[model samples]
Target: MYTPGWQIVFLDDPPRLKPAARLPRRPFQYQRWEKNIFSRGKTHTPVRRTVNICPMHTLSTISSRKSTQPFVHALAWFVYASVIYSANYLANPAIKLGDTVLFLVPYILTFYVSLHLLQVFSRLGTIWTIGGVALFMVASTTAGHAYLFVILPKFGVYVFNPAHPEQFAKDALLGFLLYFSYALLYFFADRNIRRRIAVTDLRHQGLKRELENAKLRELALRTKQENMLQEQAFLRAEINPNFLHNTLNILHAQAQRYSEELATNIGKLSKMMRYSIQTTEEQPGRVTVTRELENLQLLLDIHGLHCKDPKLVLMYIDGKPDGLMVPPLSMITMVENAMKYGDLTDPENPVLISLIMRTNELHFRCRNKVMRRTEIASSTQRGLANLKRRLDISFKDRYTLCNRKDGHFYNVEMIIYN
Candidate 1:
């Protein structure tokens, strides 16, 4: 029930109590055993369950095609061969067992050779098909009995009767003719199967692309929800009144010395308020660079009035701003720190604020005499800490803040993208 960062403590030993019967109990070794189980490295892989909408339909299509051409060819060939053999038995009264054996020899040779040749020579697809047909015709012809004459005497069929050789040859030729038809049917059926397979492959590719796009959209939505939760936490923490108190004290000092300047500063402060209050709710925030500097100048004016030296320098190098937007309150935090901790009351010491916009980025640099570490520890860097958190939540890796102290001076630098 406890992790490395948590602790369990008991004030005093408790009284003895009877153990329950229904609940299971384990020895102290169970705790160590549980730790090992939970401490194992993750090996979870995402499983995607997909429903194939057209598989049943595709299967039925393949079955339909197979039944029509190839199945019919097989059935027709068997039936045709049986009918011919039966008719010859009934009509050829003089035909013997030797005559029938001789008749089947040519048909068997032609069917086996045609099937083998078609498989070996793909470029001769048309020729093979035509040759199969020609073999069928020769087998169908009664004249093919002449081919059997060469082997008939050896078999003793031709010597038995003069018509023996011719009649046996016709029967063999008929068998070859039927087998050729079966081969043609097989070739066309194979082409159709290939086409079906290509269509299935294309459909699978489209489904994969769709699944990938759906996953990307889900990830984007989850990221958006995480950002919203972070923004809500920031707004809840922003309700403390410390920052507003500092602004009021500075404004009070400015009101006594520069009435006209005080009014201008207050106006700019009001405009800044409109942006800052809303940004606690909605960020990524937006403020034009010109507006950001105007707000910075207001704080600087108040600081100038309150300090004993009553002088601070504001300068902009390179170009001025033109409608470029930046994150709200990014520059004012540094300027306030410069006024609070910098040695501004010393006649020789002054604070400098520089605003530069280059390459679609805003640069804020503040320099002052370094305040001691003990002084910073006492007062705490609340404003700088709050600003850093806001920047991290809104801009993430797009912003940077650094504070450096050399021997005599303190420097704060910030870079934020437009």
Candidate 2:
């Protein structure tokens, strides 16, 4: 069966009664409620209430719009070159072709040459930078000298003059001045473009991380659901809930005609069995701490009906459970172990179960007096083994379990860090 993608509510379905909280029909719902259930003498909830961690948006589509600065930079330089050529062309209409070669060609060449020189300077320091600028100046001046004096004159754009040696100085100075202005503009433009690219990369990384976490959670849920379904099928085949209910109802009706105490205990037993069945089938790794403790009290009450000692067990709560949850049946398994092999006849040293909840942690300790060799058989502790396995899958290493045998008692303590 396909489990709901959001969350299972409370892990409670008490046989014939309505569930404590209803499960939503749709998959991947945005808001998920924590394991919040139960009310005994007071109300308190201490868990993370709202789980809004659902992957809602598409992560593959990185939100990196191409920066418009590049296009703007190209246009600005184009206008700069055009304006110089236009003014020169208008002032001397007959020499239109010469003005294009004189102003536009050197200016465009200077812009690109300065950009390359700046990259070399930034990366390799002053030594290599000096060589790079010298190389650029020589190459650009030689090309400019040839275009203006030899090439342009061949096309009837300008006349060559051997006497005007001052013309070479003017062309070189003009080229250096163009380079200086473009370098300043390139510095700011390059910085801004790099900042935009860095921001886009950071955003893409964050989205990628979130998508990965979402996928891992989904896979865990699928694997856990499959395991639960297999166990539920096995359980259903071995024992039918409807048949148990009918048989319990019949026994209860007959016991009520003879004795009220027997009938009352029978009803409680039926309820406990129903709760146990539902928990195995429905737990979403965890069940409400409050609800599990309440059922624990019910189990104790049932045991009380037959046990001779009035002080069979003691449960102490240092802080309110709030809405905290633990792996289903973890607490119950500890109690079951104590009831089966612990000495409960003595009123002073009874089974002691204590729970302490703090700001960011929870502590649980179960201690009981061990029965003598004559009173109890050898124990295999299969229940505690299964509890550890369940906890490994649910809480991983976030919780700690320790069990030790004292001189005459057994002690088990667990700590869950929030």
Candidate 3:
């Protein structure tokens, strides 16, 4: 049998294989074989078996190791106390080293027990812990002093004078102050360390929240962008059907009279369609000013061929179109609106379209005499509104569009800053 990566072999009888090392034998334990059996002239492929250990069992084993830590700390404290007092004994020849060691025994025991008690009480509250620690320091200090002065004299290690009450009082006060000061210092230092750790933890949590918020904002922006692109694509898909309808109508009209002109117009329409589709798919939906102007001229030519008096529809271009780009079909949209609703029959007040470029700015102006006495109820206004929206989305505040009616002439003007 073939295994994924490794193989294991088991023997029924305990026979010493040439290159196999024996593992410690247990009732259910199996030996892990790492080397391939082919190297040892084995004919059959071996199957590997995996023994799964429970996570709870591993966790219990790790927890068992923590029980010895308190004993280790106690041993370390005992060693530290022994070294310090032994040095003191060596310095003073009057006190025997054994007596000094015996002297430290009660003090160490009282100190550790008080420390443990304080640790337990600290979880209750600050006030209670402080009171407990103060009381412990006082009791331990008094007990240690009594042992040193009263009990040590009995052992003939040191002498004490009960006659001088002032000296005894002074020594007791000094011992109390020393023990109290040490305890308070340790307590304050530990509190300071814990406070610093708490502050660091709060700071880390605040940074983590800020990072999460930043990621959420980025995700929202990406989703918004995706939605906008999807809407643009939907709008683009809608345009082709309407555009083909108008182009087909124009082609049908031209085919009745000039078949040669119909072929040329069809090619122009095809180019325009390709450009429109390509520009809509682009991120900014932009094209060069030269390309926009060429398409606009094509639109004018188509409109002029259909109109009775072609001279009434006029277009003028001023300055070079170098280093200039614009949203596709933007300029042509205004011209189309003018041509659709303008009084083109009147040669005196004809539809006028002008594109002027000055430095880094491009200005476009369209003026057309309204043919109808009342407002023209057509899709012209809706198309203009859609164009305005596209301008706002693409150019932001970099362009301006204005439309006003002066007497009989409806004028639309736009300026785009490159």
Taking all chains together, each candidate's TM-score versus the true structure is 0.39, 0.43, 0.45
- Residue clash pairs of candidate 2: 45-322, 46-323
User: Distance from true position, residue 238, model 3, in Å?
Assistant: 7.0
Q: Identify the superior model by lDDT, candidate 1 or candidate 2.
A: 2
lDDT of 2 by residue, 1-418 (tens): 2222333221111112244543333211233334335634554443233332222232222122235646876787678767766777788766564456454666577777777676646444556667887787777777777777787676666633657858766867776766757774775575455444444544565799899999999999999999999989887754887578668888998999999999998887787777777777784678878888888887788878667877778888988777777877788778878887888787889999999987657898899998777332345267777888888887898989888887888898888775
Model 2: how far is 261 from its true place, Å?
Answer: 1.5
The true-structure Cα RMSD of candidate 1 reads 23.2
TM-score for candidate 1, please give it. Answer: 0.39
Question: Model 3 reaches what TM-score against the true structure?
Answer: 0.45
For lDDT, candidate 1 versus 3, the one ahead is: 3
lDDT of 3 at 259: 77
Over 40-159, each residue of candidate 3 has an lDDT whose tens digit, in order, gives 565554544443222343334435535775797579767866786678768875656567666656555654565566555644456776788778767765776687677877877653
- Assess each prediction's global lDDT (C-alpha) against the native: 0.60, 0.68, 0.69
lDDT of 1 by residue, 158-268 (tens): 632555755555555555657655655665466445445536644676698899989999999999999899878776657543366457556756775768676665655
lDDT of 3 at 24: 32
Task: Name the weakest run of 10 consecutive residues (lDDT summed) in model 1.
Answer: 25-34
Runs with alpha carbons beyond 4 Å of true place in candidate 2: 1-242, 374-380
Highest TM-score scorer: 3
